[model samples]
Target: MNATTDLLRVDAVKKSYGPIQVLHGVSMSVARGEVFAIIGPNGAGKTTMFKVMTGEVASNGGTIHFDGRDVTRMPAYERVRQGFGRTFQVARVFRDFTVLDNVIVAVEARRRHTGEAVGSWRNCAPSADIRDEAMSLLADVKLDALADGAARFLSHGDKKRLEFVIALAGRPSILMLDEPTAGMSPSDRSDIAKLVSRTRKERGITVVMTEHDMDVVFGLADRIMVMNYGEVVSTGTVDEVRNDPKVREVYLGKEMVSA
Candidate 1:
């Protein structure tokens, strides 16, 4: 892909925790407006890889380029400003705050980051425009009705959806979801998958996700990257990865080919 189309490029990223190493020179590229998935069994360094890319933790080596700028050393919040929005494996939200407040906080943060004058949360309530924008984002995830409810009281599935809305408030160019459907029922999982698909298509947002559910992975990914023992084993389209013998032996079973 050309420079304009290649939105994210990770060149030989490596990470280590003292004596132990987690990532061994991992490299990948994500084109704009595509769903790229990284899949593997437990302890495959998938989450670590996400952490590195998102700047939650520093990479020991290599570089990360986004939107044609080098962002390898950028802080997590700065990366967010640079258009990287992410959700963790567990839903992270303001549990004590009302659902509406949760998204309002995100919207205000985005505005503040962009040099807009936002009233401090302690000094004043969110402005009408801010409230409207937050509500609009909540409505997108069907969380508008629960706007006044305490976030802690929401169900796990609802919390996941809320977190998604909060992420959307950041106005991301690329969203990295770490297990977007982790603890949901099959139906709830389907809901999140559909939400992701619909949102990506509507907004033309690029998505990079790591998920264990084969159905979700195959359903969403335009290209799949298989990781094993901290390194990539395969990278290709759905059919190519599914048919790869190495991926089958290390991750997918032979039965998956027929399915």
Candidate 2:
């Protein structure tokens, strides 16, 4: 896809801390409604890139554009306002809150002004309309039956699903999922993969994902980006990436390429 038409473009981005530099002129593009996967060994700057894109961490150099607007200096909340939603590698939900409450909290935050969207939903339980909407979001993820249950009581996989529901409630145009299947079982991975697929199909949201599971990445990604040592080694479709010698050497390794 052309850079001008890309839904998201990270150009020549760089990041540093004290004397250490993490990202080195990294650049990539994601088209609208595409599943773009970033894969690399740990500390390869995947999380740092996410942090920069979501506006949690400032970049030392380069620019970031989303849907044709410059957002390099935009705050995290503003990115959310710009229809960019993200799920952390770890599932983050209200421990003391119920499943429905978790979704309501996200919905409330999504609708409220930036600064006012903090704390639990307990102080401001959702209205009937929001409750119904939150329930619908839960149903979309097949978690409606557990709406009243405490989030702390849910399993890891269930909590991940809850995260997806919460992200859906916010109505993100581009969803960023970091390590979406980090600790999941095969079944759980498949389920979450399907959920991501369905989100793309049903909502037409562009999905930017970082997953270690090759099966999930190759299976779901319309384009795959391989990172090694804070640089992009390859960016192409599955077949193109699979056959790239640089990818096979730097990212995939001999075992995986052979597989």
The segments of candidate 2 whose C-alpha lies over 4 angstroms from its true place after superposition are 1-4, 113-125
For 77-158, candidate 2 gives per-residue lDDT tens digits of: 8899998989989999898999999998888777675454344557565577778889999998889999999999999999
Best by lDDT: 1
Query: How does candidate 1 score on lDDT?
Result: 0.94
For each candidate, the alpha-carbon lDDT, in order, equals: 0.94, 0.89
Tell me each candidate's TM-score: 0.97, 0.93
Tell me how many clashing residue pairs each candidate has. 0, 0
Candidate 1 lDDT by residue in tens digits, 1-259: 3568899999999999999899999999999999999999999999999999999999999999999989999999999999999998899999999999999999999998898867666767788889999999989888899999999999999999999889889999999999999999999999999999999999999999999999999999999999998999999999999999999999999887679
Query: What is the RMSD of candidate 1?
Result: 1.5
Listed per candidate, the RMSD to the true structure in angstroms reads 1.5, 3.2
